[model samples]
Target: MASAEGIFEGRLRELCKQCPPWYKNPSLVRLYLLLIAPMMTTTAWGFDNALTNGLQSIDTFMNNFGNPQGSTLGFFGASMSVGGIIGCIVGGPLNDRFGRRPLISGGALLIVGMVIMQTFSSNFGMFTGGKLLLGFGAFIQQCAASVLVVELVHPKQREALSSFFNTNIYIGFIIGAWITFGTFRMTSQWSWKLPCILQLALPAYQVVMVWFCPESPRWLISKGRIEEGRQILIKYHGNGVEDEIVRVEMEEIMAGIEADKTMIKANWQGLKTVLGTKGNRHRLWICIVTAVGSQALGGSFVAAYLPQILDQVGLTSSKDKTLINGMMTIVNWLTAIIAAFVIPKVKRRTMFLFATAGMTASFIIWTALTAEYVKHGHKGLGIGVVVIIFIYNFFTSMCWVPLVIAYPLENVTTKQRAIFFAITLFSINVSAFCSSYLNPVGLAAIGWRYYLPQCCFNALMIVIIYFTFVETKGLTLEEIAIIYDGKESFEEAVHYVSMELNAKHSEAVSHVEEHTEVKA
Candidate 1:
C-alpha cells in the first residue's frame, strides 16, 4: 500500500489528470456557478460594512439617526456583530441537525426581512435592532455556506474555489461603496435607505436559488445516505463517469465519517467531542486566531472607519471620503481576486505569514504618515496617508482575504466543521465587535494614536500565525487530517478503504471484459 501522503497526492493528481479543466467540462461549469451563490452570501456582510462606513460620512444619515457618536455610534457599529454572536452559537447545532441548504436559504430569507426593516426604520433603536437581526441571519448562512463551498467542489478545484469563497465579499464591498457614493449627495433619507434596501439583492437571490443547488455530499454521507452521496460524487466530481478518483474520495469520506461516528451526536455533547482531542483543539485554536486576526490586524480599522482615517489626514470633504472609499473597494477587489487565483500555487501558512507581516509594516508607515500630515498640515503628506491606506489594503487582500475561511474549513472534520466555523465566527464577531465599538471612541479620543495599538496588534498576529498555523496546500479535506491526527489514525482508514475500492473496481472491470468477449 502507498504511504498516506503518497496515496493522497497520487489520487489528487489522477483526478486532475483525467478530468478536463473546469471550463471544458459542462458539469463542472454548472457546479462552479452553483457553488458561487453560497459563496456570495458573504457579500451581505461586506455590504453592511461598506454601507455603515459610508453612512457615517453622509449628513442625511447622521441627521436621521440624531448624529450618533461615541457609544451610540459604537452600538450602531457593533450591533450586527452582537447578532452574529448569538446566531453563531445556534447555527452550528442547527446545521448539524438540518443540513447546509436549510441554513443557507433560511438565513438569506431572514436577511431580506431585516434589510426591509432597517431600510424603513423610524428611529435609532429601530435601525440598530434591524442591523442586529441582520447580523444574526447573515452569520447563520455564512457559517453553513462557507462549509458547503469547501465540501461540494471537486477536489481538483477545491483549493482555488474554496479560496475564492470569502473574496466574494469584496464584490459586496464594491457594490456598497459605489451605491453609497452615488447616494451620498442626496438630501433625503433615501441616501441611507437605498443602500439598506439594496443589501437585499444578494440574499434575496440566494433565498430564491439555493434550493436549485445540491446538498453537500459530506453532509449526506454523515447522515448515512451513502449511496446518495456516492451519486453526487459521480455526477459532479466524476463528470458522469465512475472515475477512480471519485471512488477514492467517496471511500475517504466514508472512512472519515466512520472514524468520527462517536463524535457525531446531538446537542452540546457533539461540540464537547470536537475539542476532546489534541488535533481538534489545535484546529480550534487556528480557527479562532484566524477569525480574530482577520478583524483586529488593522484591516477593520480602514474597512469600517475609512472616513475617519481620511479625516485625520485633513481630507474632511464627505464627497472625497466617499469617493476614496469607492476607489479603495476597486483596488481591494482587484487584489483579492488575483490572490484567489494564486492561492492554489502557494502554501497556506506562507500566505498568512507574508500577509500579516506586510500589513504590520504598512500600518507602521501609515501611522507615521498620518502623524506627519496632522502636524505639518502638508497636503502631500495627507495624500501619502491615503496611498499608505491603499498599500495596506493591497497587502491584506493578497492573502488574509482569501485564506480566512479556506484555512479553517480545511483543518477540521465535516462532523465538527460547522461547530468549528461557529467558534471561528464567534471569535470574529467578538473581535469585530470590539473593533467596531472601540474604533470610533478610540479614534475620536486619541486621534492617530488609535492606529498605534493596531500596529502592535498586527505585529503580534505575525508571531502567533508563524508559531501556530499549519500548511494545508494541495491536501484533500480527509488527507489534511493526517497533519493534525496521527498518520496511523487517519491514513490507515484511507489505505484500507482505498484497497477495498480498488479491488472491487478491478473485479468489476474483469467481469466487464469477460462479458464483452462472450458477446463478441
Candidate 2:
C-alpha cells in the first residue's frame, strides 16, 4: 500500500489537476461543510427504514408485535405513510410561512420525541401511533431538506448536488441492516427495541448541528430579505469575487420570485389554488404521478416489506432473509450514488422515460419469474427471483430515487414549490398507504401476481413522462418558469441564455431576462 503522505499527495494532485481553483476556496468550502447537517436527517431516515424493514423479519419483532398477518402487517406499515401525508400537508404550510431552517431544526427534535414514543410503547396502538409520528417527522425533514439543498446551489450544480442529499439515507440503511443482523441472535426483545431507541442519537445530533447551518437563500429572497440571500449566494458561489455568475443567478432568482408571486394561483388560497389554473394543474399532475409511481410501483416495496415478502416466498431462513435485506440497501445506496452522477449528464425527460421503461420491464419479468418459482418449486428459479428483485431495486433506485424527489423541486416556482412538494408528498402518502397495505395482501392473495399492479403503474408513468415532461437540462431556475408559463420554448430559452453559460467574471444581465413571453 502507498504511504499516507504519498496517497494524500496523489489525491491533492488529482484535485489540483481535475478541479478548478475556485473549489478550493475557503468560503465555498465552508458552505459545503454546513450542508452536512441538513443531510444528516436523511441518514436517520434510512436508518429507521433499514431498522424497521429488517426487524419485520425477526422472530422477536413478530412475537412482540403479535405476528401480524400480511394485511395486518400492511395496515401497521400503512400508518407511517398516513403520517407522512399529514406531515407534507402540515409542514408545507409551516415551511412556506416560517422558513426551511426552522422547519428542519424543529423537525429533527420532533423525530427524537416520536422515536422515544415508539421505543417505550406498551401496545400495538401506541407503537402504531409512534410509527405515525416517525413518518410525520421523517417526511417533514425529507421534503424540506430536499427543497433547501436544491435552492442553495448554482444552476449547473443543482441536479447533481441535490441528488447527494439522500446518499446518507442509504448509509443509514446499511448501518441499520447490519445492526439488525448483528442482534438477530440476542434471544431477547432488545434486538428490535434497541434500534428504535438508538434512533434518538441522529436527531439529537442534527438539532445541535442544523442550528448553525445557513438558511436557504431562496427562502430568504422570497421573504424580501434580498440582501441576505445575495450575501449567501456570494459567500457560497461568489468564490470571494461576487462574480458575474452570482449576479445573473440573483437576477434569475428575482424574476422567478416575481413570476411566482403573480402567476402561481396557490400563492393565495392553498389547496384550491392547486386546482385553479392550467399551469397549476399541469404542475400538480406531474407531482402526483411521479410520487405515486415511485412509492406504489417499485421503491417502497423493497424498502419496507421485502424481508417479509422474502420469508413468505419460501426463503424461510431468518438470517438469510435479513442479510439479503441488508445487502439490498447497500446496493440501493451504491446505485443511487451512481444515478446522482449519471443523471446530470442525461436529459431529465430522457432519464425519466428510460427509468420508467426499465422499471416496467423489471416488474413484469419479476412477476413471471417469481410465478415460475412458486409453481415449479425450482431452487434455481428462486435464486433467479432474488437476483431479479435486486435488479428491480436497482432499476427503482436509478429512476425514482434521484428523479422523483429532486425533479419536482426544480420544476416549479418558489411560491408553489412547497405546495407542489406537499401535493407530491400527499400522493406518496396515499400510494404508499395503499402499497403498504396491499403488498402483503397482494402477495398472499395472488402470489407472484403481486407484482402485476406495479408493472401496470410504471407502464402508465411512461406515457405521462413522454408527453407532459419537457427537457429541464441546462436551464436555470428562472428560465424554467418561462417554459411553464408559455413564455418561450425550452430550446429558445436555452439558446437565449447560452451566452452566459460560463460567465466567470460577470456577464450582462440579459441572460436572466424572461420578459419576452413565448406565444403558445
Candidate 3:
C-alpha cells in the first residue's frame, strides 16, 4: 500500500509539471484570492460610510431636507473626500518607500477603528470626525491594494487582474447598500450604523491574513533584494519551477528600474517629465479628461443616491426599499464579474463606446419617465426609474468603473504612476464632494433635470473614447508605455507583446523538456 501511494504521488507530480507555470504557482493564486475579500470589505465599509450611512446620518440630523441652519452635514459628506485627498497625496509615496504590506495592514486597522467610532457617534461632530478618519483609511487601502496587485501579478494579466480589484469594490458597494437598506426597517440609526460596524470584520480579517502573505516580489526586486525576491517566487511557485519564473520577473523588474532611472525624482520632476514633452503632455491630458468624463457621467451620484431616489419615487416602504437596494447591489456585482471575463475579449475603446451610448440612452429614458410622472402621476413611472437605476449601475459596472481604475495604471510608467494615481484620486474625490452636495439640492430644485447634464457628459465620453482612448487589450506594461508615448501603434504594441510572451513560454517549455531528458 505504501509503494502504491508513492507511485500515485509521483504520477501527480509529473502531471502537475506539464501544467502552465501560472497554474502551478499556488502563492500567486492564493494572494489573488486573499486580496478579494479584504478589498471587498474595505470598499463596502468605506462606501457604507460615504454613500449610505454618511447620507443617512446627515438626513437624520438635518431632518432629510438638509439643515435649515446649515450645520455640518455638508462638511460630513465632504470629510471623506477631504480625507481621500490627503490619503492620495501621502499614500503613494509611502507605498513606494515602504512595502505594500504595512500600508495595507495599517490601513485596515484604521478603517476598523473609524467604523467603530462611527457606529457609536453621539453627535454630528463625532460622526464627521469618524468619517474623515474612515476616508483617510480607505485612501490608504485603495492605493496600497492597487499598487500591490499590479506589482504582484504577471504583466500579461495585469489589467484583468486589476479589474478584479474594481469588481470587489462594486461588490462591496452592493453589499453595503443592501445591508443599509435591509437594517433600516429595524431602526433608522441602527440600520445604518450596523452596516458601518459590520464593515469592521473585513479589515480585521485582512490584518491577520496579510501577515501570512508575502510582500510583492516585484517590490523586493526593485529594492535590490533579489535573493529574497527569488526565494518568495520559489516559495510561491514551488520547488522545481523557482529559477525560471524568478529570472523572467527579475529581468522585467530590472528593466523597469533602468527605465525609471531616467527620471530620478518622482515628485514635481516626475510630473514634469511626463508632461514636459509634447507627446507626454498629450497622454496626460487624455488620462485627465477621461477621468473627468467618467465622473461627470454621474456613476457615483447614482450609486450613492439611488435609495433616496427610490424613496422619492414612492417606494418608501422599508421592506421594498431594502429588497430593491439588495437587487441593485447584486446586479452591480454581476455586471462587474461579467466585465472581468469580457475585458479580456473586448477592446477597451469598444467597451467604453457601447457603455456610454447605453448609459445615455438609459438616462434619457429615465428623464422622460420622471417627466411623465410629474405630468400624469402614474405608478409606471416609479418602475421606470427603478429600471433606469439598474441599467445605469449595469453600464457603470461593465465599463466606466473598471476602465477608470485600469486605464491610468496602464497609461503611466512606474515613476509617474504614483503621481498620476494621486492626481486621479484627487479628481475623483473633488467630483464626489461637489456631487454629494449638488445632487440633493438638484433633486429638490430642478427635479430629474440633473440627469440631462449627465446625458451630455455620457455623449462626450463616447466621443472622447472613440477619438482618444487607445485600445490596450493584451499589451505588456512596457508595450503599453510605448503606445502611450506614440512610439508604437496599438496593433504593433499588441503584436510585439504577444510574440514576446509566446517566446517566453516556448523557452520555459524547452527548459522543462531538457530537464526531463537529463533526468531520464
Candidate 4:
C-alpha cells in the first residue's frame, strides 16, 4: 500500500527523471501540488455558476429570491460576467503591477467575503450584490492563477497541468449539480445557503496558501528584478544547480522579453501593439476568438442554463434535471481529464475543427429534438435532446477546458501577455454575458427554437476556426512569438543552445580523459 505522497513522487520521478538533472529532482512534486491549489479556487466560480442555474429551477430558491422571471433570471445569471468584466479591467493591471501571488491572495479574500455576503443577504439586492462580488473575485483570481501556472511550469507539464487546471470547473459543476439536486428536496433556505458556505471554504484556504507561494520569475525579470528572479529561477527550474537548463530557460525568457519589446513596440507599448500592428492583430484576433469561441460558441450556454433549458424542452422535474446535470458534469470532467492528455498529442486546429463540427451537429440535433417535443408532446424527444446536449458538452469540453486560456497565455509575448489576456478575458465575459442574458429570454420567446441561433453560432465558428486560427501546437512560448511577429523563433534558439551545451559537455569529458591519461 503506497502512500498518496509516495505514489505521487514515484509518478513524478518516472515522468521526468531522465530528462535533465533539474527535471530529476524529487521535490518537483511540490510544484505540481502548488499549481493544483489555485485550480480548486477556480472551481468555486464554475460551481456557483452551475448552482445558480440549478437553483433557478429549485422551488425553495425561487420562493426565497422572489422567483425571478425570464429577463430577470437572465440578468442574475449574467451577474458573474458583469463582475468578470470589472475584474478583468482592474485585476489585469493589478496583477502586472503588483505580482501574480498578491492578486491570487486578494482574489481569494474577495471570494471569501462575497460568499459570506451571499449567505447572509436578506434580499434580492443583497444576493445580486453578492453574486457580482463572487464573479469579480473569481475572475481576478482565475486570471492571476492561470497566468501563474502557465509561467511556472515546464512545457510538457503545461499541457497536462493547464488542462487539469480548467478541469476543476467540472468538480465545481458536479458539486453544484449534486448540491442543488440534494437540496432541491429541502424545504428551507439552508438549501441555497449551504452551497454558498461551501463555496467560501476552498478559496478562503487558498488565500493563506498563496501567501507562502513565490512570485512568477518571468514577472520579476520583466520588472528588472534580476537577482530576485534568478533566485526563484534557481529554486524552481535550476533545482539549486544553476546549471545549463536554468541558464538556457532564463536566456530564452529574456530573449522573449526583448522580442516582445521590439514586436510590441519600443517602451513596451503592448496594448497599442496588440490592437495596432497588422500581424499582432492577427494574434489578438485569434486570442479573442479562442476566448469568445470557447465560452460563447463552445456550448457553454447550454451548460449554464441546463435545467431551465431542460424545463423548456419538457424535462421539468428538478430531480431529473439535477440528476442529468450531475451526470453531464461528471462526464464533462472525465472527458476534460482525457483531453488534457490529448492536448499535447493533438494539434490546436484539429481540436477547433472537431469541436466546431461536433457542437454544430449537437445544436442542430438539439434544436430539431426540442421542436419535436414542443409540437408532438413526446417526452422521449426531450430526453433525446438532453443526450445531444451531453455530447455537445463533451466536444466543447475537450478544447474549451484548456485552450480557451492556454492558447492566449502561450501565444502572446511576455510583455503583452497581461494586456492580451485582459482583452481576451474581457471578450470572453462579453460574449458570455450576451449568451447568458439572451438564452433564457430566447427560450421563453421561441422554445427549443432558441437553439437555432446556437446552431448558427456553431456553424459560423467552424468557418472562423478553419480560416483564422493558426496551429499553436508544439510551439514554446518563445517560438509562439515568431509564429506571429519574429524571425528567430524558440525552435531555432533551442537548437543553438543544444549545440552549445553539447560542445561544452564534450570539452569537459575531453579534459577529464586527458588529465586521467597524464596521471597514468
lDDT of 2 by residue, 1-520 (tens): 1112221123322332343444666766677678777867678767877876887877888888788786667778788788888888888778788778777877788888988888788877798888888888888877777888788765556777776676777888888898888888888988788877888887888778877777888889888898798888887777666666676566656655654533333355645655665766777777887788778676677878777567555687879888898888888889999999888778988888877787788778777877777788887777777888888888777868777777777778887787678778788889989877887787777766667767787788888789988676755566556655654333343343433343622343443343333321
Question: What would the TM-score be for candidate 2 when compared with the true structure?
Answer: 0.87
lDDT of 2: 0.74
Please state the error at residue 506 of candidate 4 in Å: 18
Best by TM-score: 1
Instruction: Using lDDT, give the best candidate's number.
Output: 1
**Two-way lDDT contest, 2 vs 3, winner:** 2
**Model 1 per-residue lDDT tens digits across residues 1-520:** 2123764556766667677788988888888888767989889999988887899988899887788888898888889999999999899889888989999999999999999998889999999999999999999998899998889998888888888888888888899999999998999888888988988878989997888889899999888887798898889888898778777788889777656533755568865777677887898899999998888888878878888888888899989999999999999999999999999999888988888888889889999988887789999999998998899999989888888898899988878888888889889999999999998999899898888878887878888988888878777887777677766655667677778777987998999999999999
Which residue pairs does candidate 4 place in steric collision?
none
lDDT of each: 0.86, 0.74, 0.66, 0.76
Cα-lDDT of candidate 4 = 0.76
Model 3: residue 67 alpha-carbon error in angstroms: 7.7
Could you give candidate 3's per-residue lDDT for residues 347-374 as a string of tens digits? 8888888888888888888888877787
- The reply for model 4, stretches above 4 Å from the true place, is 1-24, 262-271, 488-520
The sequence of per-residue lDDT tens digits that candidate 4 reaches over residues 58-152 is: 78778987888788888888888899999988877787788888878888898889888988889887898889888898888877888888888
Model 3 stretches with alpha carbons more than 4 Å out: 1-25, 34-38, 45-75, 187-189, 237-245, 261-268, 486-520
Model 1 CA lDDT for position 113: 97
lDDT of candidate model 1 versus the reference: 0.86
